[model samples]
Target: YMQKVAVINSLEEDMKALPDEALAAKTSEFRGRLQKGESLDDILPEAFAVVREASRRVLNMRHYDVQLIGGMVLHVGAVAEMQTGEGKTLVATLPAYLNALEGKGVHVVTVNDYLAKRDCEWMGKLYQFLGVSVAVIQEGFSQKRKRAAFNADITYLTANSLGFTFLQDTSTVDRKDDLVRLAITRPFNYAIVDEADSLLIDDCRNPLIISDEPDTGATERFLLAHKVKTERVLRLGHYVIDRKLHRISLTRDGMLRGRPPNINDLWEAAVPMGPYIITALRARELHRRDVNYIVREGEVKIVNTSTGRIMPTSRWTDDLHQAIEAQEYPEVEIKGRTKVSSSITFQTLFKYYSKLSGMTGTAITEEEEFHEVYGLSVTAVPTHKPRRRIDHEPRVFLTENHMLRTLRLLLTKARSQLRPVLIGTASVADSEYAAANLRAWGIQHQMLNARPQYIRREAKIIAQAGVPGLITIATNMAGRGTDIILGGNPKGLAQLALENTVLPAMAAEGLHQQLVSSLPLAQKSWPKFAQLFPRLKAVVDAKLGAHDTSEGPDVKDAGGLLVLVLSMQESERVAKQLRGRAGRQGDPGETFTLVDLNDPLVEAAGLTSGMEAARPFLQSARRYSCLPELSSLTQDAVERTSGM
Candidate 1:
């Protein structure tokens, strides 16, 4: 690593000396070498140097030596565990450029469509400056647009899109012309997944499937099951539910009561009613309103458990989705399921890539999983500055209500100090409840969740979260990609302008006014910003106007941003991602995790503990029990499932 950095550093001085035209010409020259049979490794040093110079000139952000090391780690097909503010997005450019030279697309996979679009527009500027084409894959794009995006030198997309596209291609068996619309233009060449742990480990179990034509019989069965009222089923003792496991079984009496006429036939055939009962049970007991999903436009949308984003295209397999629609919007059509024409797990899909790498704020805990599944290892990239975020010991309570009360008090205290607080909740319901509590106290704050409406506004919400006395509540989706700037985000002025209109002149003038009056930036920071973004500057007498450099710091004296985590995620890595939002780029900040024993993670942990404690007793009983094999097998299964 040191040797590679040394070579890259040696070329930087020479590359910086080139004129703008000369620097721009270098991209073509590098392409020429690659076309002439030179490996990416052969041009690594100079190519990285060129990118470094380009970023400095274009974005005014210089790649640190550590970032260069991270870039190299990614280029070699490894996970670079860089911290929250280490500019992993910029580090991607090095490898992205090198790999894109091969003319087979390099995919920069993000956690969601919002990030995919944000990064493509943000980083596409840098790549476009270096003569590389970029495109984004998002929902609602036409087939032609998707093909165009996939054909780009570097395409930014969610892992779901990439997986679904692959599945779609598999369904196309007709002819060569038909394949054009279904296929992703490039082969599975090189991919750099953002939030690697969330995508590769936490969400790996679910397979991507393209359904065949809807089965009307299955739809009828779902409709019939939906007609059986929940209260009637419970009152009649027709179903037994295991709340913790989210499973339901039909009791003998209940089975007889609700059993279809062809119960015996269902035993041997693919029973639609069996799945209907399970799905109904799960929808009623396991999936809570707003907590697990939200009702929007009379449709049931699956909330991404890890990110707190609404996934409109995603649906439960079997009859689970229709079961949900049946329960939520009884008047709407109960969509029937198609046969799974094609399917692939993320584990299997990622394996098709010629080369794979990933970057995330946290990955060490799942290091073994990464290596075992993707043949990738994690490397902790050193931060540009020493971390100063104070992580307080977690506080535990007996119930969620008690925790909420304590959380309210903490928010009140943080508000008094004028420190912007970001509270990370586990679900949309939890975040909504937090918002409600804050509102009851008349606390002014912003709420972000997985609702479709909030997805587009996420970038701005997160960006300005660090301003004085701002209380922003969000789900895990806000944890990655977005950066929480200390005091204020100056760039947000430009973003706001662009969002308001597409006209460049209007945006530039509008951004100037917002920067001068609206931002909470320190007076000293303005001149530096004006110089960095000359196009957005409104000058007077060869100097920035007095209004441009007059704003005072809003919350710098309040100890910067404070992060509050309301509940624990299933993985410690995810918890770390939330805490990471507070202390960024060595900024002074603090974070605390308040836990309730009723939280899913806490409940799971307790269950694991109970299972472990009972293991020896089960073993002892097995020695004398007639069903020794079954007992031993149950013990082993418990150990494995509990990760003991």
Candidate 2:
């Protein structure tokens, strides 16, 4: 890899000397070489050099040596475990452009629609400048639009969208127009999965299912089961829950107790009462509101556990969705159960590609899974600069209140230094809990989670999350794709200013609401807006200027973004990802974790029992408290269990 980087660097000056037109012409030139039987490896160095130079010209961002190595790792169809903020996005352009020369399509899979669109628009400029056609596949895209996107040289989409599209195309359609036609027409060529661990490992358990035939009379049974579980069954006395396995079962006493009035009717209708009761119990005990899913406009929406984003089109399978709905809104009309027509897991979906590669900060932990499942090796790419982030010892508290109190003190200290703090909570409910405490403490902060309002303004909130003295509480991995620029992102600030100031004024003047409503559309029509309303440009420019001149240096001096993890995640990878948010591009930062002994992770790992077993020993050793050591042990155990 170093030798290849050297060769690529050797061609950098020559590539730089070429004009924009000539640099872009290299795309066609490479295609001609490939047509003449030259392999991608034969042209790798020049191609990388071309991409590096084009990036410098178009995006004004040059790929560092380490990033070039990361690109090479991807081009060879391996996972490049690059640290966060190490220019993984730019590293992708190299292999994507190189592979697209075959005209066989390159798919860049992101975690969600927001990232798919964001990366397409952001990196599409570089690809387009190099004369490579790029498109993004969104959930609401028409079939024709999807066909066009798939036909593009490079396409960006989520793993769910890709898997579902493949499933939809295989539905034995009678007419061509009725089909997505993606799998039938487009070849499964090279794929680059961003956040590889989340997609490949964390999300592999969830298969993409397309269901159609609705089962009648199931809603009543589900509602009855939910009512029985909530009103009759006690958790400890009537049922037992295995949090790690996500299983719940009724106790002998509960089974011996009288059944619900409609239980016989449900059994006669072919719906087993035991399964319904167990499903209802699981829904009530395991699926938490605002944690596992959210109630938006009176509808239950499943939240993606890995990304902490709402999967708007996703639902629980096998009557699980109806059970949750029944548990949440018993009075409302519950949707009927649907039979699975077709389904595909992410593991099977990615395996369909001819060549697969991925980039993530946390793939090393699951490298064995990658190699075993996908036949891909994990390569750790060095960061451009040394990581200066300080990871403090975990502080364990016996109670949640004590943990919150310590968190408050830490936030106060961060505020005193005018340092930005990112509070990473395990779930939306936890984030809200932190938010309520912050509000009571008179602390101003932004909360980003699966809530409807936060979803729309995510970009803006993450943009200012790193501004000096600003506090942002986000669920798990809320802003995974977008970088929280240390000082404040100037472009993001300007966009925020336009949305806050200019767009409202445009609406007041009776301008087309759609034109001003959508940020991208508004940006496209900005020149006209500037001509008609001169103040709009002034407002945006002022914001850009002020952000450019202020706060960033102070933030750096005070130390970069401080990441405060309220609780340890089930997997150490997620905890590391949260810490990765800070100290980007070698910036100085610190990470501190406060663990509640009663946290679900602790309970799930059976650490609570272990701690109890050592309680007497801990009490005797007054001079040396091992609470922190025990907390670390708990985290290790959780990570081990998660890997299993």
Candidate 3:
């Protein structure tokens, strides 16, 4: 860790010493180096130094050597696990500075309208300082606005926003009518994903495509008509399941019912209850929702689940969205939508970068996944100060009911401890259940999950989470990019304390005594012993601007923030992300759950069967039984799922 600090400090000095001419010239040298088939590693230091200095001259902001090193890692295409508040935005300047010279343009992808605009205005300074023009894309921007932005040397845009625009751009009758349409020929340049994991991985499974079709009533009629007919058939199960093929076939007895002509004409391929039939029905019955997806006028508008913003321009292609809407609103028009063009998959999108690398606090365990999927390995960046987080493992249960009872008990225990606990739930339904149960038990907790607004308000809740006796019920994923400190939140003191040095006298101060003790030895070495340490003062005064502040007062006492997760999520990926929420950057944190037969993933994966066998013996300890130490079982499940 100290060596890393030394390297960072050295790089900062090197950047400060270089002259503009000498620094800007590094771009040419690196380009030449690349042309000669030299390794990026060979030119990384000089290349990074050049961009670092260039950003200073161009944007008046100099990169910390750590940022330069981060840029180097990105240039080599790896995941740099930089912590929050480490200037990840400025860090990209090194590489964006290098890649922009290729003249292909670079795509800086963000999560929402807010981030896109914010990053451009903020991070754009570095690019502009370095002689690169920056443009931002937001929803509802005119074609001219989009064109001007995309034409810039570096274009910042939201992942879905850009994708949807790409689709709309291509569908325009005249190419000259829009900017994205104009840039259609520019080829996708380097794309730097902000919150890379969400846009690139969590959303990878969905395709971004452009579709075109002549609107007709025939398609609309089919949707309404099918919904009416299938509604009855589904309950009856017109087909019997073969299970072996995971297929449902039309039963001999049910086939005898004469097929209705209207339904037959619209869906000749859809035999009710068969795989195709079920899929078409499921698409309508389960896919689209007014809350998550709204049908405005005649078109389907996909809601941004993470942000809760209305994606007005987002549409369902090839009739899927329309089909689902038809089931929900039988009276609405069900228009035919067709796919016109597409380029997707998280792997393919990130691969477009000539050089790709990023810092995320949560990438070590996913190093292999990153390598396998995006061909990027993970490199851990030590924190400036030793982490002092504390987390605990789940206490398991035999049944969902038992898990609930155990949770109530745990919640009671947590409230008694006065060590604010954050409970992560697997579903919206689960969140509601927990909320109701907690309320019944006289527990006061804040709920945050899939609601789009909740994510935007992440800092607010996390900021308040440290208040002793506060309980926050969050979605399993709500913990990302946010840290929980111990000894309850020192309301309004975080920004000042975290960044500035804490003084001995300040440490001895009454209200903050508990907080100062939570600091590591290195943290306690700062200059003053005044009323407030510089770090604490800095944290308190830090201008978080529009972005959420992570600065929290350090606290001492029993285990830090208590993290209580109800069930393990479906993907091991989620399980990893959950554990990651705690113990950030070597913080002393513990994470535990009450896992048993009640969790859906366990049942789906057959772990519940094993629990069933062990149920009787573990009755008295029902709700607190931890997941048994079954190595062979875990290994078998992992392999089986891998094969699947």
Candidate 4:
């Protein structure tokens, strides 16, 4: 794949040897070709050639062969499944340029504000070099700045920010006046969604709704979410010794109103009026504070079950978060009103991507889900280097105690070897648990999760993850655009790293001398490629973020990162991400998981193959406990009535 992709990109590089005037003309020629009803596929070679030359001129950055292949996929309305550390930022340029030709605005969707603005500033030079307008949409931008960005040929924005704009567009007091929509009728066009999995899968269940105002009405969803209702909780009994909190139960009155009377009536168990419950939340089901939620601004904030950060955007619907909150403090302030912003689930949002495609190193495992849900297909993009991580089968233990104890042994072995450690956890609580336990073991470490002062803190911690014997506990952080450097490990370990990881940039810079040598004696207008070649060299020279090459104590030298998998995952893709942090680019690293049967998802959904696991958990809960008895019936009624 690398050889083939490289050959193709080389041909594009050849085109840049022409005069500057001729080089600029490629943009017009490509657009003209598109205007003449040429398919993007028909224009692929020339269109890519055009971008290749222009990126050289503008950003002084050249696309690698694989990056170009990923770009080609994007231009053709497909996701490019490139690995992390590959230049996705650059890959986007090929398609962004091609799509912009239609004169319909292109929206480059990022997972967060940091990326949105960063890309616009970093890659915007290339777009501007090609004479295409570019802008980034971040949170809390002034109306004018946002409007200017939207007016550009290409606007970069986060999913939530863009969704907020769509909602704001609808509620604009004047029908003809709005910044988000220049036409006031035009919806957004092509979007290259970064962190596609998080948006398309993880967030799919939560639907998006835009209302003129906040919905103050007490819907069960808001009033009953575990995060929100948890604030008013009064604990009647202490939980199991080690755990801070316990399973939630229903109050007597709640049981009377909520639980179905005939929980065993499988036929009619779904009756809405039953004592059947979601919380079954007795007045005194065991509850804990640090593990579940944290008090912020006198208000209870629900922790993201996966990341252990305060879910500022999430609200308890039907007393779920709130129910959990009520369990925490008897007097946590009530989240009385919720305004439905423009909200859409990942499932629904992806379906709207005029043309849908995405790339992830781990998407193949979720092929069935993608196909079944979105009618999308996954194509394996071969990695430039063979993966060399030492993957051990999940080490399942009977209890959390056993799992932690085994983990200590593993940590001791790695620490002895001076291996750098990166522990991937499932949720915030899990990350915390691992961090707390490691601290107890006299192991100092850093944590990156839902910390409020997000940016500087995260960057500071991640920088040293590549160092030997340095331990860092994180959630899905390393899997996404994160890089771990060698931090100057021992000779033996560094050699293993070189053997495992594929540093294409390092390879490219070596070619730089050849590039200079290859320059024609009678120089043509190869200015763009000349400019880009050096920048490409710089990108390689640039520290891969936290994977710095600094040669000192601040560099935090360590062996390969030892990933402590503290939490269990339901999906293969998730487990892959956790493990993906190690052995990136074929780097030698190790991954191991400590699975405790008591994890909530395992407890709620049960351990089995996807659908089978879900079925048994649901059926057994229905049989043994009294929860979800009425949920089945009510959901049917709602689905039937709403035609959803």
- Candidate maximizing lDDT: 2
Across 1-644, the per-residue lDDT of candidate 1 in tens digits comes to: 87988999999889889988899888899989998999899999889899999999988888899999999999999999999988998999889988998888899999888788878887887898989999999977777888889999999999988888777766664334566576486678999999998889877878777776877666666766766545446442667767556678877766555555546532455654666765776677677878777888777788877777777777787677888877775645667777876788888898989999999988987899899989899999999999988997666554466677778888888888878899999899888888888888788888788876777677778766876677898988778778887655656644554444433564666755665474456344878866875654542212222213421144655676889988766556667888998778887789888865455665555444544565556446634222233334432432333322
How well is each residue in 452-563 modelled by candidate 4, as lDDT tens digits? 6543465456656676677788866555656565563233233334323434445656754554576454135446644756653344344333244443233333335567
Query: What would the TM-score be for candidate 2 when compared with the true structure?
Result: 0.92
Total clashes in model 1, counting residue pairs 3 or more apart in sequence or in different chains: 2
TM-score of each prediction = 0.83, 0.92, 0.69, 0.70
Name the runs in model 1 displaced over 4 angstroms: 173-183, 227-229, 233-246, 256-274, 399-401, 493-556, 607-644
Per-residue alpha-carbon lDDT of candidate 3 for residues 1-644, written as tens digits (9 for 90 to 100): 23443554457577667776655555566667778887655555555665665666666767665565666666666777776445677777666766776667877776667667767886775665555688888888876787778878888887777776666655563455644345345667677666666555666666765545745544544454455447545444554543223334445444433244444432345433233344354454444354456545655566554333455545555455655656655445555545455445455555655666656655675677677778778776545456665444444455566667767777777677565677877655567677998888777888776555665665566666655567888765454445554433354335434423444455556636665466555344545533444544455445332113332223224344666777655455455555555554344455666655655445556666766776777776633454445535753563344212
| Deviation (Å) of 144 in candidate 4 | 3.0
**If ranked by lDDT, best first, what sequence of candidates would result?**
2, 1, 4, 3
RMSD of 4: 12.2
- Evaluated at residue 536, the lDDT of candidate 3 is 49
Clashes of 4: 76
Q: Which runs of model 4 end up more than 4 angstroms from their true locations?
A: 1-7, 16-25, 53-61, 173-185, 210-294, 300-311, 321-332, 337-343, 454-456, 488-559, 601-644
Error of 4 at 556 (Å): 14
User: Tell me, what's the RMSD of every candidate?
Assistant: 8.4, 3.3, 9.6, 12.2
Candidate 3 is scored at a TM of 0.69
CA lDDT scores, all candidates in order: 0.77, 0.83, 0.59, 0.60
Off by over 4 Å in 3: 1-68, 81-87, 98-104, 121-133, 168-187, 195-202, 213-276, 280-319, 330-353, 358-395, 416-418, 452-459, 465-468, 476-558, 609-644
